[model samples]
Target: MVGHVVRKRLYILVFAALIGLTALTTGVAFIDLGKWNTLAALAIAVSKASLVVLFFMHLRWSSGLMRMVLLAAFVWFAILVALTLSDEFTRQWTPVPSSWQAQVQQQAR
Candidate 1:
């Protein structure tokens, strides 16, 4: 039923876009983006997901309320990812030396 609803041209274009994005992701993997590698990959991934949701999932023709719900869901997901990444990025993994070792050795004497 869904396939019967969407036009052939639209499907063809979406397929082409998906293929192009796949090639792009592969190409980007070979590039040195330094700290921006994750950001660039994420951006491309989001674009591909959006296209799939809009066309393949038929959300583009869905009701306004459905679109609003999807938008809200995406916003919530972004907030969660931001919060998690902030915590991750700000964490210090270095081990700090404590004076307890010296104190323990002194006590042993």
Candidate 2:
């Protein structure tokens, strides 16, 4: 079976990109971004995944249908990630009652 022959230069470039992105991801890990830390890491991860999929998997030379399917899958993944993060961010927000005010009133009386 015949296929597209990827050039060595392209391979080297992709490898470099993967390495650099990995370094960036590692550096970002030590920094405290608070709530944005997870998002930042995920963004870097998606870029790395894209590089692997497009070059290593040869998806870049594939047909439009294949690309469209991948795009749809990415969209679904994004939706799921967004929903998960939303839940995570809201998890700390528990509803507080007026119990503290009642205690203050009793102390004053």
Per residue, candidate 1 scores C-alpha lDDT tens digits across 1-109 of: 4433887899999999999998999999999999998998989998999999999988988989999999999899989989999999999898757688988998999
- Cα shift from native, residue 79, model 1 (Å): 2.1
Cα deviation at 39, candidate 2, in Å, is 1.6
Off by over 4 Å in 1: 1-4, 95-109
Give each model's clash number. Answer: 0, 0
Q: How many pairs in model 2 have backbone atoms within 3 A of each other, for residues 3 or more apart or on separate chains, i.e. clashes? A: 0
lDDT of each: 0.91, 0.95
Clashing pairs in 2: none
Q: Write the per-residue lDDT of candidate 2 for residues 14-102, one digit (tens) a residue.
A: 99999999999999999999999999998999899999999999999998999999999989998998999999988877677768989
Return the lDDT, model 2, position 24.
98
Candidate 1, residue 92: lDDT? 83
Q: What is the C-alpha RMSD of each candidate to the true structure, in Å?
A: 5.7, 6.3
